[model samples]
Target: MQFMEDLKHLLDISYPIIQAPMLGVTTPAMVAAVANAGGLGCLPLGGLSPEKSLALVKETKAKTSKPFAVNLFAHSLTSEVSEEDIKIMENYLEALHKKYNLPFEHKPISSYRFYNHHDQIDILLDEQVPIVSFTFGLPEAQILSQLRERGVKAIGTATSIKEAALLDKAGMDAIVVQGIEAGGHRGSFIDKEPLPQVGLISLVPQVVDTVSVPVIAAGGIFDHRTIKAVFTLGAAGAQLGSYFLAAEESAASEVYKERVLSSTDTSTELTQAFTGKWARGIGNSFMEEMKNSGLVIPYYTYQNSLTAALRDFGKSGGIADIISLWAGQSASQSKSGSTEALFNKLIQQIKSDTNPIF
Candidate 1:
């Protein structure tokens, strides 16, 4: 009872659900819809410049008066890709690019720039966002202090117990415990080594036990069953991503949505080929070819720019093989509907008498 009340109080939400931030896939309307439905809506600001990030935040605020979170990638864009390195990746993709008959060339190294979201924090402050979340790593303690001074709640993503403890020690208002079953980018930041994959069922309880702040469980969570399970595991709230990929307000292409809908629990793989960062997505031609070619480039933002054109072209042409179909292990369980309608269904499940705990 205290957990439920504490979460609702902390997030200013009616339900213990959060619309997990999807960097490029979610839309302002989708964020607003979740906010309007009384759940926290998180808008991911990765891959966009600070100016663009602020514009998107203002747009979402214009659509809803309720509180919403704005998330940014905490990755450093060091630009370690040498010209020779670019040649290897480009030469490899050239053949496939011609097979698809799209102009093939390496994007200029000058085209890519990555920052650790410092400017984005300034934008969030200027916009007076109600909540801010960081993935990949935590922001500076002073930044969190500033946000708290301005009444902005700080949230961070943790893939392991130690990561959660770090965020808790950093004094974040909440920590999103992202298990291995989660789709999209791996939020493991503390270790430069291969991070151990922990499942949601096992991860949430341990994180909750270790942290004084609220724990929001994110992974292969779908319908209310998984949500209840997380809550029972001691998570204060649930965070879902693929569940809304097909929402009318989402920006995902038809091809992407179709692929997400058709994927099996075992169809997804964690590959760094697309963005030079390990992220879970359905296997495709590009993923397969990159896997066999043994090419690695600059980390995300930089690496993501190299494939931006192909993904755009594939989306426009309804070609699924060349584009990413980002989804969680429970991709096949997702349904299409308006965000409001989906939230209503989720609420019905939450209110079910079958769930003995509220």
Candidate 2:
């Protein structure tokens, strides 16, 4: 229990486990279930407006008094694409839209708005949320200092040891060592090209050795064996995302859940078709079509917007082929159940393995 002890003092959790802050998938019910089950549940605020983010925070608080974390996308804001860029993307998506019987009319782009980490930070401080975490990049010195000043624990995601050290230097309370096996967008902090695809077993210990702060292991970690491995490697806790996608309380669409459950060993791939940034998801018709068409669109947020209508259409029509079924390599291990049941099962398994026979 020493591993859980360390994490509890830092994150105020009854269990060392923390649910990964899954954007667009983790629901209030999911978060509450995890918290109620003694692990820290994270609610992602990456895509929400400031007001909406505050409302979510309030709703989460209403559901559970146990500590939780809120995650934000710490990226710089850029202009909406030029007319030419939009047209280019539109043309590329046109054939696929028609093929999929999706909406062809280009929806008017919302004025590009960047996540105001500062404003969200202020909101967190006001709410006195116990933990705040970020991905994509680190915050300004002032932001780090302010969080520390207010006693809010801050964690950052890193895809490399260098990024982990940088996060420690930037005053992060802990660093999530996001291995290559992680689902969704890759949180490459410094490197332009991908780092050697380090697995969790190797990456966690390396990051722990490099950084002075606590290392939380992520990526493809599903069962108690993987959890025990990370702890043995010196990770203070384990963060999991893909498993929650199948939790009954998860906000993931029914179609998305079915696709994940039906996935074979070769079902997933890393592609940037949906969000522009490289992310792992179940290989589907859209991904196959993109490969055949051979068109790489803009970076994440932009491409995400471009495919927004398609994703919406897929969701509304109960079609899983067009939606992004974000998941990790161990996604095949996911079993559909209530969040409480899943959390208890995982916790029980960890306890049984770690317990000493008299």
Candidate 3:
């Protein structure tokens, strides 16, 4: 278990388990709870303004003195959205809005502008977050350098061995091998027609073999068995997100949590219908209807902004079908309750094994 020991030492946590930094779902309380319970807690700051990211960091620190990580979206925030593209998507969304009896309007170009991660990096450095991880792609070399100069550990997400090798060469302390079964957005940064489709079992060992940095397996990993399976696959640790969607501290609405808890392996599918990026979520009427409409979805941030109001309406009205219910393939195995209880149960389950990895 040298890999496990090395990972724990590197993260300064008692366990190698990392609570995935699930944006829109993870809260300061959940981060603190995981950090306090002997695992690495990650506050997802991807898509948030610098001010809000800093506030959440401060709030998490107020709850726990333990080390935790923060994540950022390293993808390009800006894209040229042609008027034709905008009109096409708007027209499609307008129909959905009318069906829902919701207000529909045009969004200006500035509405899609997101606060870049470079600005957010200043907050991380200021707060002295122990670890920083990014998804979608690697950050600028200078950003990674600044983090290292500050003695902060950096982790990167990769869906293929090529991406993992790039991050390792870039001096990342760790790499999350995000398998295809992972929930949320596909972390495939390389420009290709089809995304990488490796499963966790196939991905972890390859990334582990390809990268010099510690490999953390992510994707459809839910319980103690899956955690152990990843370790056996040569992963130093496991990064789990969907497993926590039902945690009491999660920001997911009641309806969303209910959907996650009730869903089976077959309930979810990968689609670009919502955010214009390939993300796995429980399939619903919105995704189905949008697919049937045949309007090409815009790129992330653009399509994300266009659908923001409808998602807000769905969330506020406790409507399950409209909101994106992001979850891993094994989401049915997820447990419900407080994070502390969930962690304790997971720990107990692992220890119950006659020869435990941790």
Best by TM-score: 3
Q: What is the lDDT of residue 342 in candidate 1?
A: 88
lDDT of 3 by residue, 1-358 (tens): 8888889999999988989999889999999999999999999998889999999999999999999999998987655667788788998889889988999888676555586688799889988999999998889899999999999999999998888998999999999999989989988888654688889899888888888878999999888899999999999989999999999999999999999989998999999988988999999989998899888888887888889999999999999888988888988887889998888788888999888876
Which segments of candidate 3 are over 4 A away from where they belong?
none
lDDT of 2 by residue, 1-358 (tens): 4544666789987788889999889987889889998898999998578899999999999999988899987776663456666677788888778977766776556665546576588888999998989997888889888889989899999888778888989889888898888878887756356644677888888888888777889998888888887888888889999878888988889999888787766678888788877788898888887777766466657788788889988898898888988988888888899999988988888768745210
* Residue 30 Cα positional deviation in candidate 3, in Å, after optimal superposition: 0.4
**Deviation of model 1 at 256, angstroms:** 0.9
Least accurate 10 contiguous residues by lDDT in model 3: 107-116
C-alpha-based local distance difference test score of model 1 = 0.85
TM-score of 1: 0.96
Ranking by lDDT: 3, 1, 2
Residue pairs of candidate 3 with colliding backbone atoms = none
Which prediction has more favorable lDDT, 2 or 3?
A: 3
Local distance difference test scores for all models: 0.85, 0.82, 0.89
Better of 2 and 3 by TM-score: 3
My TM-score estimates for the predictions, one after another, are: 0.96, 0.93, 0.98
Candidate 2 local Cα displacement, residue 228, angstroms: 0.8
